[model samples]
Target: MSRRGWVLFLAMSVIWGIPYLLIKVAVDEVSPETLVFLRCLIGAALLLPWTIARGQLRPVLRHWKALLLFTVLEMAGPWFLIAYAEQTLSSSLTGLLVAGVPFVAALAALLLGEEERLTPVRLLGMAIGVVGIGVLLGLDVDGAQLLPLLAIGLVLVGYATGPLVVTRALPDVPGTAASSIALFVTAVVYTPFALPQLDGTGQVSAPAWWSLAALGVLCTAIGLALFFALIREVGPQRALVITFVNPAVAVLLGVWLLGEPFTLGIALGLPLVLVGCVLATRRSPARTEPSELADVDSAVP
Candidate 1:
């Protein structure tokens, strides 16, 4: 990676990582639906004009069905689920759970017929990642907190499947335009649910408000731009390494800022998950799938 790539990588690592913490904060004062709506609304506000100015919106709109799926898979479902999960799950745990995306993405590729050959190493990696999840759950999470695990499960699926949809269905769509439009569509979809909560949002605290603003502008809009550029700069496989960095930042921020608990489960499980991600996403020597990395990369949002 070049200096520019390093810059994007570091920037995105922090940018994407903070969303978990921000959502943890924002969801304290707002419903998950309203939180997601605010995020999308703010993101679209920033990206729409830029997308339109670049004349990419029309092309992006041409693939509305795929774009809609992308919205639901990439933003709508995962965003809400993660937010909802964060209500109970620690921000560090949330980030660690989400870090399992690479494993899920690998499985998604196999299930979708995107990758016909699943190497033994990759399979081992996936198995280890599952063990990590089990350790986190069995040791760290109580039975009462299981619902958050379910929510994180949904988020993992969405995160895994969203990229496959984008890469296979709308590979040619401009990333900025696709992401911006998806944000708009998500905002629209959540408006009905969010409207009822709008009256109460005024009571949200200042920290939560700042967190929401950062979630919308920094994490969603600007993060997507940096994510897309990083994919281009470093290719999908190398660029995906940023996922490893995200959890560290999330855990640190959660511990330092939010004063969230960091336990033995995280200390043990997070390394397993990160190592599994590296193993699962590592470039196979004889790989024939040209779009495997791109497929994983597209789902970063």
Candidate 2:
């Protein structure tokens, strides 16, 4: 990677990582639906014009079915669940849990007929990742955290499913257009629910508002652009390293800024899940990494 690639890499690390903290803040005063809606609205407003100016916005509409599926799985469902989970789970924990996305994606790929074999190493990785989940669940098994953990599981599934939707359905859609359209549609879908929640917006604090702005502009819109740019600069394999780095930044920001608890379970489970994800998603020595990794935008909250 060049100096510029390093800059984009680090910048995107912070950009994607901060959303966990921001969502934690925003969801305190705003409902999850409203928070997602507002963020998407702002993100669409920011990105759609640029997409249209580039004449890439129209192709996004041609694959409306897939775009809708992508919106539901990627932007709408995961964002809402993450917001809801952050209501109970620490921002740090939420980030750690989400780090399992690549593992989930690997399983999804196999299940969806991608021709990767479930080798011994990959199976062991999957087992380790599952054990990590067990460790996370064991920590709060008797507590009210089970439902939130389930919610995180759903978010992971949704995140995992999103890339396949893009690869199979919207392969030719421009990244900006796909992001902008998906967000716009999600915003529209949540508008009725979100509108009522806006009644209490006056009571929301500046931190929350700023957090929402950052979530929309920095996390959703610019994050997509930089993610694509990172792939273009350093190739998709290296760009995928952002997924590994994001959780650490998220955990750090949560502990340092939000004062979130870093429990024993998270300490033990985080590395297990991360290492598992690396193994499960890694290409074999004889295999080439997929070029479609560049085609699909898998930026997370």
Candidate 3:
């Protein structure tokens, strides 16, 4: 990677990482659905105009079925679940749990008929990743609620399924148009829900509003553009490596800024999961990275 690639890489690392903290702040006062709606709405408003001006937006509609599926799996489901789970789980712990995205994504690829060259190291890596999950749940903090953890489990599956839809099902759709459609359709779907609460006193906090703005403008909208740029600069495979760094940034922000604890579980599980991800995904001919957006968007919250 060149100097510019390093800049994009570092920028994306922080850009994708901080969403966990931002979501934590926004959801403190706002409902999860409203947060998702506002975030996606801002992203679509910023991105769609360019796609339309360039006449690339219309072609994406032809793949609307797959596009819709990708939206539901990637943004709709995972984003909401992350918001909801952040209500209970520490931003740091939530980010750590998401590090296991590769475990589910590997399965999604094989199940979706991607011919990945699965090897012994990959299987062992998957095993180590699972054990790391157990460790995170076991050692770090005991009193965390089970329901939120289960919600995150669903989020993992949804996030894992999204990339396959983008990589295989919607191959003809350009990245920007595909992402614009995803955001726009999602915003439209949640319009009935988010519209009613826009003026609610529940979401009037200054930090909450600023967090929402950053999530939309910096994380979701601008982050997508940079991600594609990173892909162009370094190539898609290398761009995806940012996934490994995002959790660390999430954990650091959660601890340093949010005053969340750095528990033993995080201390122990973080490396195990990351190493497992590297071993599981390295040289595999499949898109199993946690931040598997097919060069279209940031990894996650």
Candidate 4:
């Protein structure tokens, strides 16, 4: 990676990381379904012109089935799950949980026979990461909120699976077009549920609205654009390393901006999680085939 690539990579890490805090804030004012709906709607609206101008609408429409599957797994399911989970879980926690995505993708690849056999180190790393997550879960302020944490885990699974779907099913599709159409489909799917929550009873504060706009425009649209560029410049394996940076930013923002408390559990568990991520993502000569699915998982969210 060049200096420019490094710059974009770090920018994307921060851009992607900050959204969790924004979602935490926005969901305070709106329901998860409503936030997801508005986010997809706004993101799709912003990307619509570019998608149209690029003439991808026809191909995307032609492959509607694949597009629908991608949207469901990648956008609708994961987006709502994350939003709903963030209602109770801290954004930093959510970001930490998401750090497991690359490991999940590696497992997915092994299960799908797309990669070399998994090594003991990777297995150990996955185990440590899971234990770290357990520690984080044990630290939850609201113990009865276990189901939401599980929901977040499921979202991470779906997020991890999304890349496999892209590589195995939609490998030829343009990334931007596929992402834009997926957002549009997600917006359409969530609209009915989100609409009822939007009663004309009270107006949202300006800050909340601005948060939503930033979530859609900066986090979704611009974030996705920069991520794709990074993937193109560096291979997916290297590009996926950004996940390591994202959680640090998220934790910092959570503490600094949201004033979320940091605890001994976070201090202890975060290093384990980061170490696990490093172990799982370490490039090895045995697995020399640059992974398309790895790239997909890295860029999925």
Candidate 5:
């Protein structure tokens, strides 16, 4: 990676990672629907102009259906799920749980007839990831928390599947434009549920407001730009390595700023899941498939 790539890479590492903590704070005050809606509204407001200026929306409209699917899978569904899960789950645990996305993404690609062969090492990686999941769940989750964990399960499926949809179905769409359109569509879809609650949002705390602002501007709008820049600078494979790095940042921020614990489950399980991600996704993707990697990269808390 070049110096520019390193700069973008480092920016996105914290940019993407801190959202889990942000969601944890903001969701404590607002409904998940409202947070998702307001965050998308802010991000779309910032990014839509760029997409239009670049004439990216014309090609995006040609594949609106796929774009809508990407929106739902990547933003509308999973973002809300992550916010909802964070209400009960610790930020560190939530980030750690999501580290399993690569495992699911690998399976998604194979089932979708992607060209990359699933070697034995990848299978072993998945097995190790599953064990890590067991350790995390066995130590941290209680029966009462099962529903939130299940929400995280849906989030995993959405985050994993969204990329495949964008890759195969929206091949011509630029990453920034696709993401901007998705955010716009998500904001529109959630308007009814989110709008009615805006009257009460004035009561939300200062930190929550700051968290929401950072989420909208830094994590969603500018974050996409930085990610596309990273991909352009360093190529998608090196860009993808940031996923392995994000959960650590999330865990550290949660533990330090929010005073969330570095539980034994996280200490043990996070390494296993991240290693699994590395091993599972080590095989080179078909060159074409990863070009819009922001599809996977952008779908986070």
Candidate 6:
């Protein structure tokens, strides 16, 4: 990676890493649906001008179907689910659950007949990753509730679908344009539910509002821009490496900022899940091309 790539990579890791904490803060006072709506609305408002300046808005509007699917799958659904889950689950636990996204994406690729082939080594890696997750869950199981686990599962499913959606449905569209359109559509879709919650008393605190602003401007807008740049530069498979780093950030933030407990289970389970991800998605010597989307879609709460 070049200097720019490294910059984008680190920026994405940190920006994305903070969103779980931010969501935790915002959702303390706001509804999940409302948070999703605000995130999309603010993110879209920030990006809309750029889309217009680049003359990409018209093209995005033209590809409304792809935009809609990407919005629902990538943005609205997962965002709400993560927020809902975080009410019960810690940010670290949510991040750990999301670590499985690449494996899910790889499985989707194999099932969908994409370029990647699942070798035995990859299979073993996947198994190890699963075991690691199991270990983590066993350790954290006492702290985790059932509904939160279910929500985390939904987040994993949504995260997994993101790459497939980008590669298969919206491949021709530039990621920035695609993401911008998706955010815009997500804002529109979330309006009905979000509107009802936007009353005066429902307003969030200053810090929470700042967190949402960061979620939109820094996390969603800038993070997605850097993520797309990374995919274009390093390819998606390598870019997915950010997932490994994101969990650590989430765990740290959860413990340090949110006062969520950091247990031996998380300490042990985190590496296992990350290692499993490495094994499952590691590029073989013969493999050349990188994935286009970089699988950063695991921005679950």
Candidate 3: residue 141 Cα off by (Å): 5.0
lDDT of the structure predicted as candidate 2: 0.82
Q: Can you tell me which runs of candidate 5 are displaced by over 4 Å?
A: 284-290, 293-298
Q: Which candidate, 1 or 3, would have the higher TM-score against the true structure?
A: 1
> Candidate 1's residue-wise lDDT over 190-258, tens digit each?
999999889987789999999999999999989888887887787767777888889888899999999
**lDDT (Cα, tens digit) per residue for candidate 6, span 97-216:** 778787776787778886467888899889988888898788787654888787778777776776666666665666787777788888898899989888953456898888888888
**Model 4 per-residue lDDT tens digits across residues 1-301:** 7987898888888998888889888888888899999999988998877889999889868778877877877789988888888888888888888777878878887898765676788888888887887787777546677777788778778877777776666777777777888888889989899898889316777777888999999999888778878777776777777888888888889989999888766887788888888777665665554443334455344
Q: How many clashing residue pairs appear in each of the predictions shown?
A: 0, 0, 0, 0, 0, 1
Residue 48 in model 1: shift from native, Å? 1.1
What local lDDT does model 2 show for residue 102?
Answer: 80
Q: Backbone clash tally for model 3?
A: 0
TM-score list, all predictions: 0.95, 0.94, 0.93, 0.93, 0.96, 0.92
Top candidate when judged by lDDT against the true structure: 5
User: By the TM-score metric, which is better: model 5 or model 6?
Assistant: 5
Q: What is the lDDT of residue 76 in candidate 1?
A: 90
Which residue pairs collide in model 2, if any?
none
Q: Which stretches of model 2 miss by more than 4 angstroms?
A: 140-142, 285-299
lDDT of 3 by residue, 153-240 (tens): 9988887777777777776566767788889998999889888888794537899989999999999889988887787788777886
lDDT of 2 by residue, 36-114 (tens): 9999999999888988998887766888998899889888999999999989888988888888888788888888896
Residue-level lDDT for 239 in candidate 1: 72
**Model 2 Cα displacement at 40 (Å)?**
0.2
The whole-model C-alpha lDDT of candidate 1 against the native structure comes to 0.83
Which candidate, 1 or 4, has the higher lDDT?
1
